[model samples]
Target: MTDVEPSTEITGNMQQLIAAKAEELFNLCDTEQKGFIIKKDMQRLRDELGVEPEQLEDVFDSLDIDHNGYLTLEEFTSGFGMFLGDQIDDGNANEQEMIEHNPNDKEEQQLFHDTLEALGAKDLYDDEETIMGLWMKLRENDPVLLRQFEQFIGKITQEIRRSKLDHRSIEAALHSKSSVHESEIKKLYDEMEQQIKAEKAKVLAQEKLKERELREQMDRELRLKEQQLSELTKKQSDLEMKLLRLNLNESETKSENERLQKGLKNLANI
Candidate 1:
């Protein structure tokens, strides 16, 4: 009997970590040769593609979909999450869970929303995450326990292929619910955006129009008050002039009566 030394060739575990850490994975992934690493050698790829080397970055930037700073294995296989878009059990929850769960029956089927929330990465997985998806992710990342304790899971996965159980109904339900939720959120956001924008515009327009209208109304009122005050002032001046003329006429008449009485008394004495 020959004994073999254990080597870390990534066996079956660590695939998720590899997929997640795309830059590091690409750095360590086995290349056809050793030429892909150097930045200066990118000109060779440019030449092979028949584009100018200076335009290489622009071309890659255009092709880069996830914008993760590098081409991941999925990108290399198809393009940007395309491999995972159609995961064998993407829409089936129950059947996918049955095939990918721990075969030893020791671990319960992990729910992504519950488990990822516990790990604080809940939003990162989205609804596409399911039992098989998480199992595949865990098996690809955790190295130490992948060979033995989690080994039987791969065996149970084969049962799904042979089983007669169906999951089309569940997939339809999940997709329908997701679609409705997404539409609701999108509609709410759009409506709020439009209403806020319209309210702001209306308030600004009203303020501008009302400011000048109010100013003009105030000016008209002030002019009318000034005209009334001027008319009252002219009437008061006319009354004062009439009172002065009457006083002068009364003084002249009193002087004439006194002289006439003195003249009559002198004539009688004569």
Candidate 2:
């Protein structure tokens, strides 16, 4: 017996339920009052929603549509709605109908492939956490899907290699520019250093010239002072000799006057 498909009303109700849940989760995680959730905040969402360790990356990548590592209100609602749809899909419609409804909505699976392609299969294969987390998702096996995955790997590998080459070219160009700038900086520094040294030498020479002139002026002043002292010493010696001659003349005159007084006394006695 074929299972009866659920009505559109049931699906609509389920969608509303999922959207409400998404809103609750968004509000819970958006603590910054911003309208979106960042990668760090996604952890809280993960914990609250009980997202499985395996599907955690897949969930984050899906809701982060623009791949800016954030989820907006609309993106969260839509992506969570798709997740809810997948969980409740068995009662609603067949796989063909699901695809008919929305062909490019391979949210988890597409994100899985893109994530692998972005990291490069070879690089991520050896990574334990990444491989373990995404291993379950890789087990999906539709022959057509498998073929598409293989084709995608080839295409993505070529693109990755081209991107690497371009990156290397850019780095080389930047290194060349940095080297040229370094050389220019060194040249400027050298020029500035030479100018400083020249100015310093000019200042030093001027100081020495000033010092020599000062010394010459001092010598001239010393000679004048010495000559003045010599003239004063000669005048002092002449003054001392005249004072000694005056004292001798005064003593001789006093003796002669005393002898005249004694002779007058003898004449009066006669």
Report the C-alpha lDDT of model 1 over 1-270, residue by residue, as the tens digit.
113211223212223332443333234432544423332333445422344665556544543666755554445333212222312222234234423443423243344334444444434422222333445444555433233212223322323333323465567778899999999999999999999999999999999999999999999999999999999999999988888888887887888888889999999999
Q: Best candidate, lDDT-wise?
A: 2
Expressed as tens digits, the lDDT of each residue in 1-270 for candidate 2 is: 113334556455544544666787789878887998876777775555445544556677866878988888888777764554333334244322443333233575465556566656555322222222212222342333233334434444555578788999999999999999999999999999999999999999999999999999999999999999999999999988988888888888888888899999999999
How much lDDT does each candidate structure score?
0.48, 0.61
Question: For this target, which candidate reaches the highest TM-score against the unseen true structure?
Answer: 2
> CA shift at 127, candidate 2, in angstroms?
17
TM-score of 1: 0.32
